[model samples]
Target: MQDKSFSPERQSAFDARFEAQKIAFGPIVFQCVRYAWKRGMLQALAEAGDTGLSVDELAATGRWTPYVLKVVLETCLSAGVVQLRAGRYQLDKTGYCVLSDTITQINLDFVHDVCYVGMHDLDRSLDAGKPLGLQALGPWPTLYEGLSSLPEPAKTSWFAFDHFYSDTSFPAILRDVFSSGARQLMDIGANTGKFSRAALAHDAQVQLHLVDLPQQLAVADITLREAGVRERAHLHPVDMLDPAAPFPAGMDVVWMSQFLSCFSEPVIASILQRAAKALAHDGQVLIMDTFWDRQRYDIAAYCLINTSPYFTAMASGNSKVYESTDYIRLCEEAGLRLVSARDDIGYCHSLLRFAKA
Candidate 1:
């Protein structure tokens, strides 16, 4: 495969300074934008159409006072989210995206609800090799353990963030999975059974073994039952971190989508070793994730790079959005060989197929 590293052309000195300022004040910018959205300022500007609204007009129409309105709108103007024309404010292209784009909304909610507060402890978490920032949410050792039990907005944002990446790739993944002619498959870390349900829907004859923690499995059970595929699905509740827990044998395929990146490299190697032992001689393992180094575009790589801190602060301090080479190395240690790697499948994801060495 070709190296997909992102290398941008050299920027002008003026552009470099602008970029530096953006990075320096990114947190403040994020909070200001989030608050503007939450307070309905963005909506009001967007709804005001091309003519836009003045600070006094926005304050009179919305719940915000003039003081808050001026502060947020001025920030939005500087950020290019909104335009000031003839003393009136209107949504710019970016502001309209903030109001209308689903990805933008999901990313914003995820950052605000799940990562913003926890990020404060990132330095401490890094030094301790633990998700110390997770204390902002709960006392779990990792984010996965506490996902099901998170508070309202955090839980909602967490799942939204997770599913947003995986769900987009499911159609392509299901095709790849079924193409292997796997009659029995195991979905490791089958959160909410979305992939399992998709697999069952794609191939009626295929049986799925859904493995996740008990709380996650319960949620998956409900979803599978509601999807009317519970009969074809077997739920296994196990703590994957337990070294003694073995994956069931005789599996034709083992599918992990956006899963392994949740753990440190050592834990990933351990899990792959277990999968290797459980696989039949001809069976295959399909691993799908966003590898920052494999992204086709600079923006995708940029997003994944920023996401690493979420792992450090909130998910697991030891894990990250890894490069494909890292995963390949771990697979080698686990007695598995990477058979093939398919990139740019759906929404910035790559699929790696493996078999026992």
Candidate 2:
């Protein structure tokens, strides 16, 4: 037997290369699905449903070209995203995760339908040092605000994206944030009140204050009633970005998940400062969402697509992901100290947890 040892420098280099490769793999898989879906392969299979459909029928009755359809279908099958049998194709879980009407698929589609459409001008946005894509309405506001002009099916699709992202990780992050025990918590941008329900589930004694758009509060009312938590939940229709004077004093915790990232840096800073005033002496603030990591992944392409001019014509631009360091600095500026920070991977998204100073 031989014992092999590598130098510390060599080991570090190998680990870094492997990490980059893992990150690149996500884009490759996305490209494969995007190419196939653009060519009508995914839709054809979806329309076929459980009954299934053959490539021949897709070209004939389905009106797809035989050669190109076959190439796309075969590629999908090879990727384990679809199944082939007796010349027919059916969706596999991977395919459904990306193509079905489920929340996960809708989230993925939002990237393709809304974000990537502007990727062509990524270089221009990078050079400008400000977002320049179709969604960029101003230096503030998120991509969600611009979808108001979108028609049905597309509008519904964006809601699904919102649901999936909010539900997937916000619950667990809240659990971790309030592990010390929370008696009263406020959820900023609390839509449908589900995140509030998650907290309630974790601790029955905790009272929930749900704040959201006025129209959405109606929806949240129904959700809380159905969940049997209305008795413990208070619905408030107010812009969370507005002044902090309305917030109840002495809150045990403040939860802002997928909320603060929607605003510009100045707004985010102000929001934190206001939130600090509402916290109890020992209360903690929780921020749960994705953050940019220059070392972990290549987000340059994401910045380009998000800031493209194409989106500006259709919707307002989204706030770019800020690094954890920036988030920490914002908290510190508000006179709060970060007691804990943890990063985790969720179903198809990223999770970040922060505890108040």
Taking the tens digit of each residue's C-alpha lDDT, what string does model 2 give over 1-357?
123222243557777786667566655657667777666678768778977788778788656678877766776786777898777889777886666545445645666665564555455655654345544322334344444445455556666766765677765576575776889898877866778877877778888887666666777788888888888898767665566436666778888876766565776787788778878878778777665442233333243234224333323233455666777788888878877666553433344444455
* Model 1 agreement with the true structure over 1-357: per-residue lDDT tens digits: 564543347778888788889889888888888888887888888778988898888778769899988887888888999999999998899988888888889989998899889899999999999999899999998988888899979999888988988899999878889887999899999989999999999998999999889999999999999999999998888788887899888999999998898899878988999988889889988999999888888878888888999999999899999999999999889888999999997789999999988
Against the hidden reference, what TM-scores do the models get? 0.95, 0.65
Off by over 4 Å in 2: 1-63, 66-104, 112-150, 294-318, 348-357
- Each prediction's whole-model lDDT (CA): 0.89, 0.65
- Residue 276 in candidate 1 has what lDDT? 88
For every candidate, C-alpha RMSD to the true structure in Å: 1.9, 8.0
Regions of model 1 farther than 4 Å from truth: 1-8
